[model samples]
Target: MGTPHSRRGNTRQRIQDVALGLFSERGYEKTSLREIAEKLEVTKAALYYHFKTKEDIVISLSQDLCGPIDELIAWAGTQPRTLATKQEVIRRYSESLRASEPFFRFMQENQAAVRDLAIGDSFKERMHALFGLLREPEAELTDQVRCITALFSMHAGMFALQDVEGDPEEKRKAILEVATELVTAANPPNRRPVRPDSAQTASP
Candidate 1:
């Protein structure tokens, strides 16, 4: 048997998953805490032990989805700012988005509700931090736009490619490729580190 703490953690995750599904299906505004508890086959009191309100559930879900992003931002901050690092950021970001697709879908489908929620501002703040990490302060306007577009491409590709026929992983790869290209273009040749092999080949 699982320990009491482990069991409680499982219950909390279950509540988050079921709540997101209900929120997606019925719309965040229409979905209630009671409905989520009913879907989970648990009592409202039991659900209350985990989340007191629908907004609380959404906030918890947001935190869970955004946690990896926060970590990525911190990780990027510690790395040297280079084209290679920026591309890796794009790759890792795409993976993070893949893991949290459902939460993102909810945000896309329920724009008004998401805007009204506190997570909206929080999410935007994280994006700004990420953008700062990707773009140089002295970079040209066009290059800066490329960095921003690189990030936007990932989000757009997730939903935009849904109706198209292709493997999901393949689509993600294609999106990552485009995002990588954008960031690479944004980074000038002067800024990219010279590979040892390239340097050797160029030697007389």
Candidate 2:
């Protein structure tokens, strides 16, 4: 038999996966806990044991996504603020966002719900922290835009390119390439040049 810890984790992940599917098919507001439980073929009581409410479900999902970003921020904090560090930040961030395409779609469709839940505020704070790591305080406005745009390109690419009809991993690499170029170009020429093979080992 599996450990109790693994069993509990499986149940929570199942609930989250089912809830996200319902949220995407039906609007977030329209999807109910009873509906989620019914679809899972599990009892309402069982669902409640894991998630008390729909907001709780979203909070749990957001926390899972934010945890890595928070760790990335903490990791970046210890490293010197160089272009390589910034590139690693972009790489790790792209990796973090890869599995969150469904969540991104939910956020896009439920902007009002996202705002009401304060998910937007929490995500914005993390972006600000990342921006701090990507650019120096004294950087010019254009360079600042470059850094922000680079991050945004990676975030937007997953959603924007979903329908483009090609290999998903390749698309991610292409997007990462563009974002990396933006950051590299934003840096001074005196800085070391970015390696051409950086994208291959970017997430590795």
Candidate 3:
């Protein structure tokens, strides 16, 4: 038999998954705790044992998504700010977005709800922190724009390519490749590691 904690954890995950699906299918405002309980085939009391309200469930989902991002930011902070570091940040961020694609879809669809919620402000703050990590301190204006665009392109690509017929992972790789190129271009030549081939062709 599973431990009580493990069972509770499973129930909590089920509630969150079901609630997000309902929120996506119906609008966030239209979805309710009772309906979530109904979808999960659980009683109101059982659902309430994990989440008290729709807002709580949304907040929990946001926190779950934010956790990986927060860790990524912290990890980047410790690394030397180089082209490799920025590219890795982009790569890890893409993976994180993929993992939380459902929550992102919810946020994109429910703009008003996201704006009214605490998660909105929190997400904005995290994005600012990530932007700080991606751009160089004394970069030219164009490079700065490249860094910002690189960050948002991942978000845009997620929805923009939905109608296109292709493997999802390939689309993700295409987005990541573009993002990586942007960051690489944003970095000053001095900041980029010299390739052996480029080294051979040096003017010096």
Candidate 4:
């Protein structure tokens, strides 16, 4: 047989996966950690190694959930602010948000719990940082608004997309495409102001 350690790792992951499903289905406040332990066929002590309280489970799930989005934001920070770079940012962000759909459902269902935990503030800051990267400080008000709308559209699109027909992946791609187009239009070369130094332009 394979190593007991490997088997134990699998069981722990399975427990977490099952717990999140139950939490989402029944609502986090209504779902008990003991019930999760029972459903996973593991003793409570075994589950405790991975999660102490039900809140701990939700916290852990949220962390595992945001890891990819954090990584994408980090990656985007290192790229140039050209159209291609912006497009990739939108694509990766859409994919990450798509991956986070379950956590979104959890947040919607457990709004009170999430608010009590104050998890929303940090998430909003992360979003502002990402959108800040997408916008030019010198951009016109309309352009800045376009940037804001484009960024939020990617986030809100995932939730709005649930009822749309066809493949979920295709819908996500379309959302990214729309966001990328908005960013591209807002950053057009002509609208971008040239510095007074006349470095890239003929002398007046």
Steric clash pairs (candidate 2): none
Residues 87-178, model 2: lDDT tens digits: 89988888877756667778877888888886789988998998887876677899999999998898888789989999999999999999
- lDDT score, candidate 2: 0.82
The weakest ten consecutive residues by lDDT in model 4 span: 191-200
- For model 3, the superposed segments whose C-alpha errors exceed 4 Å read 1-9, 192-204
The number of clashing residue pairs in model 4 is 0
Ranking by TM-score: 1, 3, 2, 4
Clashing pairs in 4: none
Model 1 lDDT per residue over 1-204, tens place: 222344355889878888888888889999988889899899999999988888898898888788889999989877778788888889889989988898899988988999999998999998899898788878899999999999998999899999999999999999999999989898975785543255357958
TM-score of each: 0.88, 0.85, 0.87, 0.79
Which pairs clash in model 1? none
Error of 4 at 82 (Å): 2.0
TM-score of 3: 0.87
Off by over 4 Å in 1: 1-9, 192-204
- What lDDT does the true structure give each of the candidates? 0.86, 0.82, 0.86, 0.74
